[model samples]
Target: MSAITLGAVRPRFRPRRISPARWGLYAFILITALYFLLPLYVMIVTSLKPMAEIRQGHLLALPASPSLAAWVKAWTSACTGLTCEGIRTGFFNSLRILLPSVVISIVVGSLTGYALSLWRVRGANILFGAMMIVAFIPYQVFIYPLVRVFSFTGLGQSLATIVTIHTIFGLPTMTLLFRNYFASLPVELFKAARIDGAGFYQIYARIMMPMATPMIVVAVILQTTGIWNDFILGLVFAGRDNLPMTVQLNNIVNSTQGERAYNVDMAATLLTALLPLVIYFGSGRWFVRGIAAGAVKG
Candidate 1:
């Protein structure tokens, strides 16, 4: 009986050999990670080094004496244009544009998606088709016409114009995202809400919106990244005062009048990218969960 009981308890640990194929896959993954990480590593190291040390030509070496002066200068006094006021101005402008554009685009897109998905609106199919087409068309095609219309209406090159431009461009994709998500939801939920005397807006506001938290997160991430990184649109529509961080970074990097401050340029580029990076990494799990939760299903 003792021997039988001992045999019934299986061994807790076993050594398993990795196959050659598995080893090759691991090597490939490591190589891929290094390929992407090398540039970022160089950027970080370079940003910490002084110009004298950087000029010594050790591109991949750690800085002999690391400092934040470059970062400070990049944030406070790096010449972006005729002004030496740094990228902080553009940072603030980006924030202003990002918040309003994200909120308005997500709200309007989600509502339009909800209406088309559940409600029996006339010409819904045609509207959806047209929007999908617009989504695929290059936005460059509409730039001239949109400029003409906005200028004709006396709304050219301002915060409002930029926000409106972001919202309009974002609508088709936003609507598609929310519409697919809404369509994937159980039909019984909508049916039950209607049976319980919930009006269209009531059902949408209380039930639908509450259940759309995941999609909303996805939309926020996408819009925040897109609007913050927008250079062309900002250059064309954001006016001089409302130029975004990307535009400022371009100016900092491309200022040909003086010797290129590589360290400052690296720091400014990282600064311009930091917000999107933070948002993406902080909410990466939620982004995956949102995508998995029927973001593409229809």
Candidate 2:
């Protein structure tokens, strides 16, 4: 007969329960969130209120007589200078500048980053250093020189010139972002692609780009916000016929000759903010992953 020994089972580990410190941390985070959200709340409430109620100085209070008249005026009838065409023209003009600028900037930046990360080229480090230095310089410093160059080229203040300016300004950061992201990827893949006799563009098109979706989302978010909120560049390079919504909104709110309409100003601001807000909200998971992945090895 064989004797069998029974073995005692070990207990599974359990996570510790939340302590008072943890609860305090949660409370702090919630309070900070609310603090930041208060201004947005005020803006929304003010935009909804009529001018009559606005004059009463109740900023945080809900509107007693809420109406969309201000919104309507901002979108269709607000005067900027001699034009009463609202912000529609500016909106279209922004699109014209934004679309081409975003596309060209991203494409150029991605390619530049890719080459710097993967390919060996002479003076690459020096070129990249120059770009980084340019990135830190104040944008205003370049305005006069860029204006002169544009004027000399006969481009002056056209859509093309503005697009070029955006592309130039956007390059360094965008290149750095993609470069860091690509550097984080496995070198084995590039080697394997090269072993198969794949050219630079072939490898980029087939492998590198497909793996860069997250970084692309991040780049889009950054560029979209910067370009959309840019007042000075648009004012200088976009000309009168190509003024963006920011310029139009500024003109409407800051005109020295007219009585300020608080409700309309707020409404226009909210509207102007809508697109970037939409982009940020819609970016969702990709934005987080992109930043995480890019920063991991940078």
Task: Name the runs in model 2 displaced over 4 angstroms.
Answer: 1-31, 285-298
Candidate 1 lDDT over residue span 83-183, tens digit each? 98888988999999999999999989999999999988999999999988777687689999999999999998899999999999888878888887799
Q: Please provide the root mean square deviation of candidate 2 (C-alpha atoms, Å).
A: 9.3
Q: For candidate 2, which ten residues in a row score worst on lDDT?
A: 1-10
- Highest lDDT against the true fold, candidate: 1
Q: In model 2, what lDDT does residue 142 have?
A: 91
lDDT of 2 by residue, 1-298 (tens): 0111112244687449888988998899999999999887887888888888889868899988789888888888888878888777778888888989888998999999999999988998898888887777887799999999999999999999999999988888888888877988999999999999999999888999899987787788777777888999999998889999899888887872756788888888888888977876797655454444434323
Candidate 2 lDDT score at position 208: 96
